[model samples]
Target: MKQIINTKFAKNIFLSALALFSTVTIMAQEEDTSSKFSLSGSIDAYYRTTFKDGGDATTATPTSFANQTGFALGMANLIGTYEMGKTGVVVDLVFGPRGTEATFNNDILNGVINQAYAYWNVSDKTTLTVGRFNTWVGYEVIAPAANFNYSVSYLFSNGPFSHLGAKADFALSDDVSLMLAITNPWDTNDISASGTYAVGGQLGVYGQFLNAYYDGGGQGGLGFEIDYTGGFDISEDFFFGINAAYNSNSETDSGFYGAAIYPQFTTSESFAIGLRGEYFAATQDGFDDVPVTALTLTGSFTKENLILKPEIRLDSFGSDNEPFLNSNGEATNSLSSFALAAIYSF
Candidate 1:
């Protein structure tokens, strides 16, 4: 069950984290080597047009790149980090529509922060982190530069985006690692979320040509989700990745599940092309089952710190589901869109 957040308790936690950060900074100041600080981020903008302009692109995929017929701002992201011996802090800030929806339901200070977390090195191979951070699940991320496609997948749209918690990461060996975390109920980017905490973890294995990971977690007041992501380098210029996920909410009797595969080919240092095919389904207590299948093809051309992505996507609804609006404003089972996006990173 969800509980009301205690203002005093939340304030105390924030103050404590601030105090710890200050203490570590002071201690590191006395050391011969001064603490290191870095600032980096990216800016993104895109233009998208749907084949059927009457039906908004936002109706097709509920995440970013939802512009219907013209140009739009994707987001501006800024990340700063401070690190010293055994301790560090990260402050990630984002502004724009994409940033706002990344943590839509929970807003602190009217939606300015993406993540503010502190970390400690417990040992050579162990580390602990506290405060809010991004979720370990999902193949795609909020950052446009990190994704191959301009549009997001349904799995990414519906899955948890970030978490508020404390987590520890351990490197067991050269090829294996693990992470364990206890966080405020799922999707709560705000630190003040109350009620029972959720437990989650990730286990990973890395090999010369292949990498695989499994992550899962749940909140008592909400539900649970499990995800698997794997990738293989088929050749020097070719690669493939697959992802699968399942989530269920006990309180609402609703479930969401999906799978996707991504394939890419890089012919040169300046150009690459990729495709993403996904199928997703949703089931609820009293509503008609909704299922979506989509295919996206994207090409990237890069020079220096700038990259350009041109993409096209097609989507279709399940036979039993209600259709989306077509160009003429008539209900239709399929929709298509074209997008061009540019990103500059530093």
Candidate 2:
């Protein structure tokens, strides 16, 4: 009986060793594959206080114009990526303080698809991406959650936001890259139906002068890009681009907006400074005959996880639409105000 029990115990030990070996082999195989495929992303959250003369539905309070404050609380965003060989898949999801505003809302939807794309290399110099994606336009961008420049450009979000279609990237050299995209112009994140469908494309070139890595850790770099996007029924108004950008509708019966932005500066490894100055116009000739041209200046400072931005924006809604909030949280007409905010990202 003792000999029989020893045999059984040996058999169990052998089986356990075999199982462990198989598990280790499988894990090693997975690791080998992952060495070829990489995945990464980030998340941003913040708390804020607001002071105002009670303006806009974006904030609903009138505590004190000089010291009105409330919670600017919300989780900014999250993103994920999967890469294999020359192909990659990336998805970005954003959640904002507003919860989720509308299906029409583009980047900040609670669980919506901000970017779900499959990208592949067509050649050493060219690559292609398909599925819902962002246009290769705009100075400020919606770069996942890992980017420090979190606040968006008015033209970034409010301009022509997103695209659902195809885009190609070509490397001109070590210093330059060009992109072209053709997209469904029903605008973005749109669920409603409109009779006419708009189709559009963008051409962009991105570049930088020089760079350095800090074993000591600091931050400063120089870069710029030009993008043009406009394909419809319009003249004297092609989305011409300089650090430049432009937009014009396809018809005269409807009004459109256009701008040329040449924003650039310098940054230290630990912090930096930059500016965005742009000119804009909106005209819808019949019931409203107004056009506006304005400029905005913004400055920011950053140290590790803390970021503070003091900005002054000037806009002329061409006598048609501006910023205003009534007692019942409603808008009356065109009015404008000034505001400042500080943000921290971790």
Q: Which candidate has the top score in TM-score?
A: 1
TM-score of each: 0.85, 0.58
lDDT (10s digit) by residue, model 1, range 141-191: 888889888789988887777888777788889888888876666666554
Worst 10 residues of 2 by lDDT: 213-222
Model 1, which residues run further than 4 Å from truth? 1-33, 53-59, 191-194, 207-221, 286-288
Q: What clash pairs does model 1 have?
A: none
- Model 2 residue runs over 4 Å out of place are 1-69, 97-111, 143-154, 175-178, 188-246, 260-269, 286-290, 293-295, 318-346
| lDDT for 306 (candidate 1) | 98
Model 2 error, position 300 (Å)? 1.9
lDDT of 2 by residue, 1-346 (tens): 0011133343354346445544554554555554244344333343233223453334422111111233343345445776654556787655553223312444334446667776765469977676676545554445323222333433444344455555667777775766655333434443212212223334333432111100110010101123443222223322222333333332333333345443434345544443444444434443334444444454556667655554444444444554445445565333233334454544
lDDT of 2: 0.41
Computed on alpha carbons, the lDDT of every model, listed in order, comes to 0.75, 0.41
lDDT of 2 at 23: 57
